[model samples]
Target chain A: MGQFILFLVLMTLGYLFGHYAEKKHYKSINKREKELLKLPVISCKNPIGNDTVAHVKLSYGSVVISVDYFKRILASLYNFFGGNIRSYETLLDRARREAILRLKESTTDADQIINLRIETSSIYKGNGNSIGSVEVLAYGTAIYFEKNEPT
Target chain B: MLMSNIEIIPNKTIVTGFGVVSGSTVRAKHAGRDLMAGLKNIFGGELKGYTELLEESREEAIKRMISQAEQMGANAIVNVRFSTSSVAAGAAEIYVYGTAVTVE
Candidate 1:
């Protein structure tokens, strides 16, 4: 009975805090994304023009996000049923977007970022690979244009 | 040294190619960070400690790669890539590689 009660309390706290954090993050992400709409992130290998380019540099962003107790339980229960685990979807979505945003933010002055790649992995597995966090890394080459030269 | 993930630098010409250079590092956070991350697993949020650990490890790996490139007398590294894997509980390996070359 005591163990069950502890589990219940942890789940409640997890739900409340996790929900709040997700909502807040989505709001911020949406706003920042809109503000950064001008910057183009592309997966192409080559920059279109060769003449106007000033310099190219590497840019990357990485993030680690953990799932709450409630969601972890929800996902395990989902595993038994064998379908889409909605709880984890949002976690991954947020992490990927956040990583890309950080990458864009880091090179705001660049003309464009090309050859973008995103990588994901689960890290810090505690017990039975049950308690682990998602890590997303986004990287690309940023192209800067010549400042004083004519376009 | 100039570093880019693409095969060629935008404005520079590749004068000489010195082959691939690579580096890797394995790292783990202290016990305090692990304890805090455990709590975060319950409440659900960003794990800042783990993020910092990964970033630091990646930097270290990139630095090592750069040193290797320097030994080869390369002025730039292009087509760089990064990979991470968990080798043990609480420990992660960051690996980075790139082609070292001279650009003009």
Candidate 2:
């Protein structure tokens, strides 16, 4: 009975610590993202078969994206023991939407964007700190497409 | 012997290489949902890492590319492509490229 109580206390402490750490990391990333959004940018490359080019430049702060196999196991264990996973999906969805909105506002012409690309990473430091951040950069030649003109 | 000088007709298009762009970092955490995602991936499911972030960035990059194309007075962009690289340990770059052209 004593061992069981001790284990419960340790688990609770671990959960609290993990939650605090995640919040701290998120706050820092948000601060950096704000700083990046303040910079000025322009797009200067013209697309093929079009005249008049507008340069659009965008920058993003750091984001941490983690894919932990062990975490999943723990989560499942909790569910079998009784917990929920809906919260995780909600968080990811929210992050994605916020990032998209920022990107959308950074441009003047939404119709001109083409050939888009996105990349992500999960970087780990030897000090047991893993940073997961997603940087989204959209760049395409902006041109006036004539109506009824085949692209 | 070197081949005689030959005239080459260049296409009425231009492309700017190595143009820089920016994107914003987006974060979302659902209390404790990522743990499930991690498990799902291990079970051979799709791993969507910052998908919204990637989608948004893709759009932004394309917008920037098109803006650049317009600035050059190009009618269209052809053979467009994208590439990504790490500018820093935690940051990723998405670049779009294509030939800016003016068609008659």
Candidate 3:
């Protein structure tokens, strides 16, 4: 009975707080994404054209996001149902976008970022086979030209 | 040294290629960070501690790769790639590799 009460309290807290945090983070991500629309991130293996390249460097961004107790339980229940786990979809979407935003933020002065790649990994699975957290890494090559010519 | 994920470095030309070089490191989560993460599991937020730990470990791996390229007398590393794997329960291994080359 005591364990059940604790679990109930934890689920309630997780639901409330997780919802709030997700809302806040989404707002921030949307605003920043619009602000950074000018910089192009592409997956092409090479630069577009023959331009005098002044510099080239590797840029990367990584983030680790933890699953709330509520979502973990929700996912486990979904697992038994064997359907889409809607709870984790938003979590992964947020992590990927946040990682890309950070990558763009790191190389603001660069002309373009090419050969972009994103990696996702589960960092830890806590006791009882419950997921603890996941990590996302976004990386690309930031290319700089000799001069920014006005078109 | 110049580093990029692409095959070519735009204006630079590859004069000599010194084959592939790689570096890897495995890191285990500390008890303190795990404890904090447990608290965060209820609140649901970013795990900044784990992020920083990953970044530092990656940086260390890159540094080691660069040193190896330096020994080979290479000025650049191109086609750089990164990979991660779980070596143990609570530990992650970050591996980085690239082809070392001299550019002109």
* DockQ, prediction 3: 0.80
Per-residue lDDT of model 1, residues B1-104, tens digit only? 99999888877899999999999999978999999999999989899999999999998999999999999999999999999898988899999999999999
* Model 1 chain A: ten consecutive residues of lowest lDDT: A142-151
Per-residue lDDT tens digits for candidate 2, residues B1-104, read 00000110022323432233223332343434455544333332222543444455656766776677677666455555555555654344555555555543
Rank order (by DockQ, best first): 1, 3, 2
Per-residue alpha-carbon lDDT of candidate 3 for residues B1-104, written as tens digits (9 for 90 to 100): 99999898878899999999999899988999888888998889899888998999999999999999999999999999998877888788999999999999
Q: Residue pairs in steric clash, candidate 1?
A: none
Q: Which of candidates 1 and 2 reaches a greater DockQ? A: 1
TM-score of 1: 0.95
Model number 2 iRMSD? 13.3
Q: What residue runs in model 3 are displaced by over 4 Å at the alpha carbon?
A: A149-151
Residue-level lDDT for A145 in candidate 2:
39
Candidate 3, residues A57-140, lDDT tens digits: the string is 899999999878899999999988899998889899999999999999999888889999999988878767766788999999
Report the lDDT of model 2 for residue B92: 45
Candidate 3's displacement at residue A30, Å, is 0.5
Better model by TM-score: candidate 2 vs candidate 3: 3
| Two-chain DockQ for model 2 | 0.06
The second chain of candidate 1 has a TM-score of: 0.98
